[model samples]
Target: MDLHVSRDFLRGGRSLLPRQWFEPMLLAVTAGALTAGGLSWLIGAHDVADLCWILGTVIAVVPSAIWVLSALRHGHAGVDLIAILALGGTLAVREYLAGALIAVMLASGRTLEAAAQRRASHDIRALLEHAPRSARLRKGDRIREVPLSEVAIGDSVVVGPGEIIPVDGRVTGPPALLDESVLTGESQQVERAEGERVRSGVVNAGGAFEVQATATEKDSTYAEIVRLARHVSAGSAPVVRLADRYAAWFLPLSVATAGLAWAASGSAVRAVAVLVVATPCPLLLAAPVAIVSGLSRASRYGVVISGGGALESLGHVRTLLLDKTDTLTCGRPRVLDVIAAPGQEPAEILRLAASLDQLSPHVLARALVDAAHARGLDLSMPSNVTKEPGLGVAGTVANQHLTVGRHNHGSPSPAWACAADNRAMLDSAAVVWLTVDGHLAGAVLLRDPLRKDAPRTLRRLRSAGIRRLVMLTGDREEPAREIATVLGIDDVHSNLTPADKVAAVHNESAGAVTVMVGDGVNDAPALAAADVGVAMGARGSTASSEAADIVLTTDRVDRLADAVTIAVRSRRIAAQSALSGMFMSLAAMAAALLGLLPPAPGALLQEASTS
Candidate 1:
């Protein structure tokens, strides 16, 4: 088949060269060869047995030879080279039975390899199939179904319950409960209020909501993931280097040994024996099997590693640089403490701030409302509430003029600057000033708490051979140090822009393999600059996930430790299997050179060593 035909089959058509086809054909040929050999030994029909064996060998070797030629044309020095040489040498020596047996072994090895590759790559295909193809576009007042390609930016789309979002957009209706489990491996339903951005592929779990499309389907988050998966899969995995380098060394060694045996013994049979024993089957099979097994294990833990190269790099990461916001903290700020005016109660100030913030769409506003509800405080909607995006909210609460926002730049009012405790809280926490009738009333301190598992996760990472753990963030020094000290991370770089973060990762990578963990659009460049970039997928920006080599499907940063452990274990297992196989093959080759092995027996020994 042509390359295009093969690709089409792999994508979504009938298999062009499926294992089923090769497996059954090889089995039938093997059975025929065995029957012919047994009948000839019983009735003395040697010519008939030779003919059946030769025919079976041709049947099995032709397809493999074509595949080898195709691979050579594509500039790939595949492992099939060794199998081709072994089969050709047996035929030249007139060892028909040995040729047939070697053919069966080659076919069985290839079938197993194909099965393992399919198992390892199941997630990529599943991701491709899960993307939505059609969208419900809102034209005027009526909604109509249209193919994703026809949906344009600025078109309004209606996402109903149980349907996947077709494009990136902003919620225009009431708060919608969305199941973003497909994009981020978290199973929780996220509530998206008006003006909040929603990505494609999330399932709308609540009632229908109208979304103003911000990006076309092709540029959506789900489509980018598909493109990234395809690009990564097309590149060769790291273990291919082990197999290629091994073949480069073993091929010439095997040929030279066989040639020397022939010249020494003046017997062609001895040379054929050497070739049979040094087939390199183990090098072809063991490394791939181990890698695929590791990938399967990682999938079970909700980490989608693109390839063996990425996994291998993750295992060797020595310096880990983390973005503080969503990577370490929860990325959501909560009301921690409230300092009211001398005569006013803290509860009264919080009540008024929460009540005014109810009309605001800022993330901190939601935290305030939730905190107020948890404290059993009753809140009422404030009249004349006004919200300025970057500034804060203002309204009339209990017939008193009130404002909640940053303090005026010129000078801090005596109510805040006079208290040492208030200054300390302002230094470490996000402080929002409250004013009543143009006088400073109080301040609300908000803190983005570190993730529950951040400390334990850092400890485990250090144990996994990470020499240096650094925090790189745009936050101020005090808050950054607060998180680093709690996590026992010694290195902290604060007030870093996205460019500074990239430079930090690049510089750290010069000393050792560095890993960058982040989850925001601003973190994309730094993520790409590291040796391996790990994206916290749950609640992470699409840009970050697209740039990251390894994506943790869940929000749990602790899974990074688990991923490192899996990668190390996989690499160790693959190395062990490959090295052990090579040693066994070399020992068998020594026996063959000493005239202790014949063609038939040598083939059996090679197969056993590989197994």
Candidate 2:
């Protein structure tokens, strides 16, 4: 079952006595009782020791009784029921010291568990606290500081160097260099030119630049991230369910044993011993501790796990489905090959194509420009540049008309024939034809290369017990197949829309736990549908990150494998701690049932087992 904290629960006011206050109060009472009982015993004042223990037990029992009543009112049974009975049994037998000790154990275990949960929620708190709160509003030639809430859409804002972008906006001035690490978890600085969209929470790494706000602070990407985080934090972890399952069997056994002991020995003392020894402390403590430790390890490696349930699910994932672009490949297209026309130089053809592409905003245009710059080729701006949405771009460079786009469907001449043959060789590469003065000049082959560590990471995932590996991508069949072949993935689903991806994940998840890793806006639906959604947070779209159960803060794909390994190790450790404690408790319970152990010694044994 999907377990989540309802909105009403968060909106509901805190308890009358907060855990912070209650824990300290309970601890102080326990300490006082222990001190008084020891001093009174030394002086041979048995009545004073009994009174001190009774006072501590009363102070502790108040909260325990309240919790049990609350649980019963909600029509549910709680693990605290056993502890409450143990306290009552000890008091009925006049074993005040044993009751006081059991009270201390229960209070201390609850406090520690609560503290671990608070620690695990640090990432969510950090996300909320780090949001930008102000912006510099631009009024013609003057800039005025204003609260982010007052910043509206269409308002011009001037972001200064090292300042966070207060809202999502379009850059209006010179190209701005921004560090988007805070927003996207990418450490690299990205360059945004005029008319390019810039998200909130990214720091301005270069000179001050003007931007026209497209969204208000409350409606910005950072706000969306904060909302998603809150939702994730409210969700319950699977480990909690695992503990409850253990308790389902354990509680009945403990109660039955206590009743059997009472009937056999005809003494309430034997029953009290059984109850004291079977308090379920290990189930209450060990699982959360292991989960918190795993979270700490993930943070050190730049992975932000949303909750303990996500970590547990990731550890047992049987099928792994991943997006192709930006996940397995670099997601950045680059010039791989340049085939020149007969007697035409490759550099000349590239120079012409890059010059014409400078006026377009298409991804291919940026790839061409970057390629030209890397070659140190100086290019002049094209004149009368025009781009047709699905066709190609056209312009005039140095008094010669040029066009770059798909190959025209017609009989190919000798000059175009050579380029066609080169294109045939690269089925996986994106081909852009270069035409100069109405003649086919050459073809530029662009490809988004596979990540260097992808193959090794895939192998490691197999070693970690991921039985099935699949690729689900919106890219064409050729590139998708090419990437799958390189990575040794057995399954490939290409050219799928967002809905198709969701359907794919749902189908896979029906049979086994499925993990979907992606980094784009289109991947959000599929991410949510998977059993465990892992987002490459660095340079990923906000939609995907918000939808993901785990966010890899770094761009390294290998970290995914490492996270799974850590999760598996953590699960094993938690099981070991809990089972070992239970084993010891069972042994102690058997001794207590036979009259070899008394209530006080049984409580001590229970404490030792849990510790």
Candidate 3:
């Protein structure tokens, strides 16, 4: 589990050791030197104290000098140049105590930044540990345990109860109850029937079942998620330093001011005082502290931000693009309404239909059965059952003939159920017609309803400064528009392919920072294309999670707003801290120039003002 630190610390090639080790090592050496120097000064061993302080100053200046030279080579002038000058200048003037203090402070700030990066990388690497390593390969009646890497497409894998599914495949036998909370964040156990697709990372919660694999281990869903997670950890970049922008001008200004002070006073000690006070400690430390704090806060709410750059961008998102299914809606179809014909009871119609559907494995059939059970309706077992795929199911329930499904050819025209059909169309629902004794009786309308908290989440997003909300979905225009109207979204782009979604994001991003939220394989490309891609990772496709810049670990969509709120607050606090710290440093520098402060006192005052 090697976690690489950001390139900023590693770019100079000055340190051969791993970047993670650099900060702690520097801190240890500086602390030892500081402690030894203070003890010698207390014992009146002034020469020994000066020697200790010189070691600390030299230790700190070497690496910072390397960093400054590296930046110069790249044509980048960073604020770190100020700290190097302060350390060297103080030592050159024989202000041993001041040089020692500056060295310790510089090392302390670097350690804090390094710790934050390690925490984030640790969080992402956990995904890799939980991935399955092997699968039960079934050849005819015999099953053998084999490494997951050896499994290939079309192989039959036997999954035991309570075991994790190893690859993407379809159920081959009786229905299997699976717990997909690790993938989707939903705690419910879903039953996948024969021929129904099941993804990796799901647990078999019920009886053991067999699956005919459709993808190899390398190409499986969970594998892709692991690959993405690894990439995030290895490629983690340093947050753009808000302080570095000030460094471009501040560095030269500090150097010139120090030169003038020395020329006027005819004392190098006076010049050292100016440089000591001008060090930009706040700019180097405050920005990373604030951003890392924001990342930690977001993680507590089940939102994982990639790095500092993503967090900063999230704080400023002006337009949000949403995917329709599994993002705004539950992605699971449920019975919403049941309309019965004249002289018929809606409950009785549903009871009869559910009774026949109990033996079927269709997704809609399960929805009807669940709905009936929710209403506390007792259903009798159907006899002489017959099924017509994509059409309907017919059987005898309570001695009365019943048929439940879509209307079929040569069936009596549903003249009396025209209102039910119209209602289904308007609501963008799937209608399952119920017929009894050859007469159309009632229709049960099912649709993927909005998540319980979706409306509230949208309201929060609006309050969080999202100026525009647009929905991009592959669903038909009618259904998409219907959902948009319900959600109060002003823009709707329907029937979009993966490429189309990317184009839509690019177009919106031209004017404002756009956030794209999605939860399926088709959403992967668009997720990568957006300014900030948020994946509904709990119970969603792992591909989207892999491509996303931010992932909601829980199933709640409202966390997105929570993350944005944290980002904005963190960035604001960072700006305030950096600007105010610099202001105080400027005032101290003025005092140094006027000779009211010497090098040792100036360094102490600089630290006090920034603190």
- Cα lDDT tens digits for candidate 3, 1-611: 00112233444556467787887989899989989999999999999999999999899887777666766665566767778878877877789889988888777767766786666455555556768999999888899999999998679999999999999877988999999766554678899988677878788999999998866886666776666555453122233446656665677878888898989999888888888888766444666667777876676676767777788888889999999877888866788898888899989988999999875644467678778877889989788988663356899998889898866537455666777767777889767888899888888988988888889899999998999999998665777888889889979998677888999999999999989999876788899999999987654565688889888866688888899899888778767776776777778788888999888888777656546
Reference-based TM-score, model 3: 0.73
What's the lDDT of the predicted structure labeled candidate 3?
0.78
Residue 438 shift from truth in candidate 2, angstroms: 26
Model 1 scores a C-alpha lDDT of: 0.74
Clashes of 3: 3
**Cα lDDT for residue 391, model 3?**
57
Poorly placed runs, candidate 3 (over 4 Å): 1-16, 72-75, 153-165, 168-199, 202-215, 233-238, 296-304, 333-447, 497-500, 520-525, 538-547, 606-611
Clash total of candidate 2: 0
Give the range of the ten consecutive residues with the poorest summed lDDT in model 2: 1-10
Angstrom error at residue 446, model 3: 8.3
Model 1 worst lDDT window (10 residues): 1-10
lDDT of 2 by residue, 242-308 (tens): 5555667777888999999999999899999998887766345776678777876776566778877
Candidate 2 segments exceeding 4 Å error: 1-14, 66-78, 149-162, 167-221, 234-236, 334-425, 430-446
Candidate 1 Cα misplacement greater than 4 A, ranges: 1-44, 59-80, 137-141, 149-157, 167-199, 204-221, 232-236, 282-284, 334-425, 429-447, 609-611
lDDT of all the models against the reference? 0.74, 0.77, 0.78
Best by lDDT: 3
